[model samples]
Target: MCGAVKFEVHGDFDSFYLCHCRYCQKDTGSAHAANLFSQSARLVWLAGEEAVASFTLPGTRHQKCFCRTCGSAVPNTHIPGLLVVPAGCLDSELSRVPTAHLFTSSRAAWDHALGDVPEFSGLPKAT
Candidate 1:
């Protein structure tokens, strides 16, 4: 990701969720969305506030904020006092883990039994 946008979260997150809803999958183009929710935390944008853009799905509360330069997910406060921060956007390490996987019934079919898959430190060597 281009480092066009930078921010700091000043308070602890209330919860972290791996959301597996259909909208979330469309948002990330992946299995789920890794989001940290906070009711009291403050997001201090250090730079590129003008480059940050947001989109809210029509007729739904679901919203996404991201850096326009690199398409990397960023924090959003569209829901009034609640701040929804994409977990992957943080430069610092998190002490808290995901609280739960939401909407499991909508989970991707290929998302099952992922622990059995092979692991690699990086991209695997060519066959």
Candidate 2:
């Protein structure tokens, strides 16, 4: 992101989820975090490795890495056998849609019934 960090995923993802845990919402600055999990995917940093920074929550398994230039989330190793890819960081197409929403109890109060919201093809014109 920010034209500095780029990467490639070398294997297929096995699962995808939308996480609504507090940490995820805070990390993503949104209602939830979309993540692709893979047991065999290899993350190959194509550029700006030096700009990659990571943080793990204290006393927790939640960890994240991001691009220093734009604070864009990037892939990071997960649980020794898996790779966590932020769906937004992927430049290519995904094989499948998110299978579930995790930690729904912690979803934002304003995030309910989103399917009813108006859809826009692009930026809505200013009223």
TM-score of each: 0.97, 0.93
Question: How do the residues 1-127 of candidate 1 rate in per-residue lDDT, one tens digit apiece?
Answer: 6999888889889999999999999999999999999999998989899999999899998889989999999999778889999998888888898999999999999999999999999999999
Candidate of highest lDDT = 1
Candidate 2 at residue 107, lDDT?
93
Distance from true position, residue 15, model 2, in Å?
0.6
lDDT of 1 at 108: 99
Candidate 2, pairs of clashing residues: none
Name the top TM-score candidate.
Answer: 1
